[model samples]
Target chain A: MTFANAGTLGALPGRRDELVAHLTRPSTALAEVGCLLYEVGVSEEHPDTVFVVELWTSAEAHRASLELPEVQESIAAARPLLSGEFGGFRFDVVGSPLRGGA
Target chain B: MTFANAGTLGALPGRRDELVAHLTRPSTALAEVGCLLYEVGVSEEHPDTVFVVELWTSAEAHRASLELPEVQESIAAARPLLSGEFGGFRFDVVGSPLRGGA
Candidate 1:
């Protein structure tokens, strides 16, 4: 089963854009087989609130990605800029038009 | 600008699948032009957690959908099954393989 994870990040005041840039770094690590999509987004209602949504091939694959050095380093780099609140939730992709038919 | 929305819903004990069914009703309202993808997913770690990831032509279109009778009714119907923790965030889709060239 493919895995879709979404999370809420509270960026330190005025550092939201910088945090986005940090996540936007070209992830050479994404070349790993399971990473389908990993994109960052800013909330329309709250600028300091950001979303990290990922589409991976499976649960195990996603778990593996977390162990990769790139994922570990990214977390370290993002810690200080974070307002200290980071929450993420995962979802199983049950339907999608991107597959040509929902 | 296209809008992508993702949300987390906590299901009342043992009511997760029920809530999913309510959300899965063939949404005729989805035929609306701006409504692209409206998918429901369950988390691998927590069965009680659900995700609603939506794609709309614009934020305004999504706002409009909320006013539709169908959308309003769904909200009402699903309320009882929800654990009362309804939170969603919107994201700007910067890249996607779905568009053929990320």
Candidate 2:
């Protein structure tokens, strides 16, 4: 099964663009062992918020990615720019169009 | 540009499996004018809830798909099985690994 996560993040007032740049750079997540999809998008309804859609080969791979130096560094840097609590949804992906079928 | 929408839905008691089957059967979304990715997942942390991650060729295409008869029918069918309100997040995708470097 595909492993997925949907997270909503809000930037501090006036730090939206800078936060988006840091989050969307994306090199660290993609280079991980089980990385499948890592996408960053800015919400149309809220310019100061960001949405992250992630897919990994397995849940373990995803957890492991957090240990990488780049991932850790990025998180620390983006921490203060964050506004509130992160709303994260984790799922066991039963299917998707990207994989051709569910 | 990739137009994306993320929505969270809660399933009524004991209807998780049935709801998942109906949502992931996915033929109608794929056949739509600009549908790109439509993924439905069940949250591991909350089995009774569902998350839908969608990608379309354009915002208009996504709105148009909603007008299709099949889509309307599915929405109607899934309505009763749904619990609380749908929390939808709209976004403009800037990059993704699925698109080979976003």
Candidate 3:
């Protein structure tokens, strides 16, 4: 089953674009670590929020990715721009019409 | 840009799988309306919650889908099983390495 991590991160005041840029930076190592999808989004209603959705080969793979140096560095770089407000949830993907039973 | 809608729906008690089944019921009409990805998931922490993530070609495409008979029918069928508790957010996808700038 594909493990999914979906959530929102709040950027300090008008720093949302900066946070998003850091998030979208190419991290080729993610694919080797079993990340199938990594998406970043911004909402008009929540100007300061950066939404992220990720799909991994398994929950273990998702967890392991956090330990990768590239991942760790990215997190460190993004920490300063964050407002400490976060919301998220995790799940095992049951199905996806496009992906056929993710 | 891809428009993303990601959220959770609470099921009435143990009816989560049922709700997930309905949600994953292969709505081919969705693709016709510019739906790119539609995923359903369940979390171990929240047994009664069904998480959904969707990617549409545009926000307008997503709204148009809500009026489709197939979509309306599915919503009506699933309504009775819902707990009326929903948590979701919508955003315009600015970038995705896998999809190349979604």
Candidate 4:
């Protein structure tokens, strides 16, 4: 079953753009490790928040990715830019009309 | 450019499953309107919440979806099951490593 982690991360003050830059950095490593999709987004209505929607092969894969050196380094790099305010939910994808062969 | 809307909808207590059922119903109409993905998810940690991550060809496409009779009907069916609490954000997708032809 596909696992999903979708949420908002609040950037510290005006550091949203920097945080976005850090997150949007290409990571071949992620796809190599069971990430089907890792989407990052931002809304003008909530200037300090960065939205993320990830589709992983499984919950375990998502957890394992966090331990990767590249991912760890990425998290460390973005930690300072975050406000520690996070909101969202993780779920096991029930289904999609798209067939999701993608 | 892809437009993304990722968020959580609060379902009335014990009605989450029904809400999910309503959302996961097959909708060929959505794809015709430029919906790339409309994923529905649920978490044990947040049993009352349904997580959704939508990818549209553009923000306009997403807005247009809401006006569809099928979509409006879906919303109406799900509304009574909801608690009226919504959390999430919308943004124009910057890019994805997947090449996103998917």
TM-scores for the candidates: 0.76, 0.87, 0.95, 0.89
Better of 3 and 4 by TM-score: 3
- Scored by lDDT, the top model is 3
Off by over 4 Å in 1: A96-102, B28-31, B44-47, B91-102
**TM-score for candidate 4:** 0.89
Higher-TM-score candidate among 2 and 3? 3
List each candidate's DockQ score: 0.30, 0.48, 0.57, 0.47
lDDT of each: 0.75, 0.77, 0.89, 0.85
Q: Please, what are the lDDT tens digits per residue for candidate 2 over residues A1-102?
A: 678777889898788777777776747445457888777788656877878877788788888988888779888999999998577677787876445546
Per-residue CA lDDT of model 2 for B1-102, tens digit only, reads: 778877788899888877877777747455457887778888767878888877789888988988988778888998889897577677887775444543
lDDT score of residue B56 within candidate 2: 87
- Candidate with the larger DockQ of 3 and 4: 3
The i-RMS of every model, in angstroms, reads 4.8, 3.4, 2.5, 4.3
Instruction: Name model 2 segments beyond 4 Å from true.
Output: A26-29, A97-102, B28-31, B97-102
Question: Ten residues in a row with the worst lDDT in model 4 chain B?
Answer: B93-102
Preferred candidate (lDDT higher): 2 or 3: 3
Deviation (Å) of B31 in candidate 3: 0.6
Can you give the lDDT of residue A21 in candidate 2? Answer: 78
Residue B98, model 4, lDDT: 54
**Residue A33, candidate 3: alpha-carbon lDDT:** 88
Question: Which candidate leads the pack in DockQ?
Answer: 3
Better of 1 and 3 by lDDT: 3
Error of 4 at B86 (Å): 2.4
> Ten residues in a row with the worst lDDT in model 2 chain A?
A24-33
